[model samples]
Each structure stands twice: as structure tokens, then as C-alpha cells.
Target: MGYGLPIYHSHCRIDENNQMFEEGREIIYVNASIQEDTALGRLMHDMFCTDSRDMHYEFLRKRVSYYKENEGGKQEMCEIWEEIKNKGKLEGLREGETIGKQAGLAEGKILGRQQGVIEERINSIKKLMRKNGYTLEEALDFLDIPKEERSTYIGIFTS
Candidate 1:
């Protein structure tokens, strides 16, 4: 959605296991109330996708001056920070585990895309060979399909 200060549009439809496919779309929203520069706020927004209120108390923790002007505000901020700190810790652990899974999925997608490009090139070579009266094996040789990967190339084209 909008990329303004109030980033409330964080939603994604996907499989339960956090797999990101080509067609999959994920929206992560950062809360408007929290300042983007704060440490806890940045962590929650960048990692856990938390909203403004969740990060507000964390921001308050760093600024003790605000507490003197508004005593109740200080107490309230402290209480909220204590509660969310625990939640943030838990979310941090989960994010650590998910990071590896996300990285693996991304690598797999990259490999798949590279293979697809290779397969397309092989098909184009095969067509050129056929037009020029060359056999499949001869055309494959002309294209310099590596001997080690001939089977894979053939499988892709034949399939």
C-alpha cells in the first residue's frame, strides 16, 4: 500500500510454513506511531513486523526525560515495555529459526531460475540444429552443452 509514516498494511497470504514462491505476495507493515530510528522499533519492524504501539514503549525506554514531564506516562511506558520485551524476545528467537528457512528457499528459487534459463537456451539450440539438418546429438555438441551435464540438458529438452 502507501509507504508513508503510518505503515499499517502488513498482510500476506501463503502456505503455513513461510515458503515464498514466485506468485506469492507478502506485505509487511511498520506501525505509524513508532519512530523508525529507535533500536527496538527497527528490530520489530524489520524482523517481526510489529505495529506502532508495540514499539512505542520500547522507544520510551531510551528516553527517560519524557517520564518526568508526564509521570503516569512514564509508568505506563515502563509497564508496556516490560510486557513487550518478553514478546520481542520470543519473536526474536522465532525469527532466527525462520531466517535459515527463508534463506534456503531463496537459494532454491535462484537455482531453479538459473536452470530454467539454461533449459531455454538448450531448446533454442535444438531448434536451430533441427532447421540445419543436424541430429539431436550433433546439435547438442554444436551448442557445447558440457559433457558432464549432457544428461540433464537432454532430459530438460526431451521433457
Candidate 2:
């Protein structure tokens, strides 16, 4: 997996937790060090997500300024700040994209999970009603299902 990139959705797949996968990329070897490196890269990559490099740059600069103010300023801190700013300029866009992709994936997973749970509940309720000798129509009425979803529930139970 290539680290420090925007993780193009066209070329990548991301899971619910924002974990990214490069499509058609095979990991033939299980190297612990590689995994660690990937994780560190991901951590750094996520810092840049937001699609706004200026925002990230300002945020980082403010953070650096805050630390310097607290420590009464140092020459070394200025050099470090410059290095950080340069690196951010070089890598922030990619990082922001990865963060955006991760956020999207996480949202999709939550929605899927919620839908799964609701479907399971609906099924269970249908079964319970059936065991009580309720017809599909009667059950739907009793459940007060919304008009939009009623047809889908009806189709499931009737079938």
C-alpha cells in the first residue's frame, strides 16, 4: 500500500473504519514492520484530511506558535516549525483526501449497521406476528409502518 496519498476511490477501497485498501494490490508477505509502518503512515496521512491545505497549515502553525509561546521561544523551534510547514505543504492534500475517504467509509458502515439491525428487528417482528397467527396485512397495520417502507416490509413478510 502506498502511504502519503489521497487514496483515490477509483483505485482504492476503504472499509467502515476508514481503513484504506489499494485495489489489485496484493500483500504476499506478512511483515510486522511493514504493518507498523503502514499504521504510522496512516496516522500521519489522516492529519491532512479536510481538502483544505490552508486550514491545516494555519492550524499547525497556530499549534506551533502556542508551544513556542509557552516555552518562551527557541531557535530550534523555528527550524522545526519550518520543516513541519514544508512537509505539510508537500503532503497535506493527500492527507486531507485520505481523511475524507475515511470519514465517508465510516459513515457508510454506520448506516449499513443500522440498516442491518432494523432489518433484523423487522424480520423478527414479522416472525413473531406470524407465530401469533397474524396475516401480513394485519401485522403491517399493527406496526404502523411508514408508507414508504410499508411496501418493502409487506413484500418481505408475504414472501
Candidate 3:
């Protein structure tokens, strides 16, 4: 109903069998709590966690950290949710097999935000280079982008 709503997904054998024209499928039903220690169960647990520290896995914690630390926290996530919901409204109702658009939209949102930040940084770097008559490296250094990350910006500038 809103951005605050926790999202969920389901992929069941019954749904798969429904798509098959020919008969020969086994539909099994079994489920467990997120407290189950399996990788998938842990991952399901991670998705609902409000804090990265509460995530069941380190890799997922880093991903959540990227949102909380680098991607500008809750407002950014809400903006992404709003964008995707508005775009989905424009595309008309998605009734079934319908999972794809939302997933694609979310991925696109993340990429778009990342590209936007990089572009803003690059523009600032260029402004410094022009105004101060500094080299790309010097501008990047002045921006405090860190030496390791500067190479990609250098490549971007050169290319």
C-alpha cells in the first residue's frame, strides 16, 4: 500500500506447474520460519531487518550499509519506491508473471542513483580542474575521493 510496506515474494511448484502445457509435475508444499538457519531462510530474515547489524549475513549487511551510509538512508529508499510505483502505474496493471517489472524498476533505480552521484562528483572535479588549473588527479585528490577510487574517475575522464 505504501513505501513503508515490507515487500515479499513467492515461487511455488504449483505456480510453475500451472504454466506447463503437458502434464508431469510434482507440487510439493513445505515451509519454514525465517529463524530456520538455511541460506534462503537467513536471507529472508535479512530482507525484513531494519538495521544492517541485525542482518543474518555479512554480505547482506554490507549491502544494507551501502543504503544507510552511501545511498543517503531512508529517504533515498522511499524515493526509489515512489518512482517504481509511479512508473508501474503508467505501465498499467501487472496481474501475473508480473514480478519482473518491479524487480527491473528497483534495479534501474539503484543504478540511476549511483550514476547520478558519480556524475555529480565528476562535474565538481571538472569545475575544480578548470577553475584552479589543476590536473584530474589533483582535482580528485582535492575532492578527497581517495587514491584507490581515483583510477576509475581518471579512466572516465580519459575516455
Q: How far is candidate 2 from the true structure (C-alpha RMSD, Å)?
A: 23.7
lDDT of 1 by residue, 1-159 (tens): 345544553445457877545545556576544646776456645344333344344554334445534687676676466446544644564565467457775655555555556646655665675478676678778877778877865654343
Which residue ranges in model 2 land beyond 4 Å of their true spot?
1-107
Q: Model 2 has how many clashing residue pairs?
A: 3
lDDT of 2 by residue, 51-135 (tens): 3333324665565555555464454565356546544543554455456557876655555555565556466665666478677
Off by over 4 Å in 1: 1-104, 157-159
Candidate 3 C-alpha error for residue 57, in Å: 70
Give me the displacement of residue 80 in model 2, in angstroms: 67
Candidate 3 lDDT, 1-159, residue by residue in tens? 222323343344346557544355444332334345777667768777898888889987987888787756565665466546544533442321235445666655555555556667867886786578788878987889977788767766654
- Among the numbered candidates, top lDDT falls to 3
User: Please, what is the TM-score per model?
Assistant: 0.30, 0.29, 0.34
**TM-score-superior candidate, 2 or 3:** 3
Clash number for each model: 0, 3, 0
Q: Candidate 2 or 3, higher lDDT?
A: 3
